[model samples]
Target: MNENFQAILLNVLPLLAIIVIAYFAMIRPQQKRNQKQNALINNLQKGDRVITVGGIHGTVKSTGAQTITLMVGRNQELTFDKLAIRDKRPS
Candidate 1:
């Protein structure tokens, strides 16, 4: 019974350590990035230039509850979900 308990602890201890390390190394950074992305999306305003995950670049024309209108070209406005806006263009 004592040996069995030791063997189980040996196996579970490494697994638990790996889970903690993985959370700090991988999951935590990803969560921070998601929070930053959400903040960027929430702060979007008209006339801000932005790039989408699809690599589309445009200026914001308007904002809706869950969507934004971007003017990608002259006389051309495209509507996209708020999540589709990835990052604001630098200057």
Candidate 2:
């Protein structure tokens, strides 16, 4: 009985360790990044400079529930989904 229990524990222990390690090494960091991105998206404001996921850099002109308008050039304003924003640029 002791040997049988020990064999089961040995087999399960490695899998449990792998899961815990993966959560800390991979999942936790990704989740933190996602939370920070979400916070940035939620707090967007006009006049803030931001870059799009597609590499377009612009100043925010307007914000909506699901979209934002950006002035990319002197007379070029583009509208995009809120999710398209990648990161805010420093003033």
Residues 1-91 of candidate 2 have per-residue lDDT tens digits of 9999999999999999999999999999999999999999999999999999999999999999999999999989999999999999998
Q: Give residue 30's lDDT in candidate 1 (0 to 100).
A: 100
lDDT, candidate 1, 1-91, per-residue tens: 9999999999999999999999999999999999999999999988999999899999999999999999999989999999999899975
> Model 2 — which ten-residue stretch has the worst lDDT?
37-46
| Residue 48 accuracy (lDDT) in model 1 | 95
For each candidate, what is the lDDT?
0.95, 0.98
Candidate 1 positional error at 20, Å: 0.5
Against the hidden reference, what TM-scores do the models get?
Answer: 0.86, 0.93
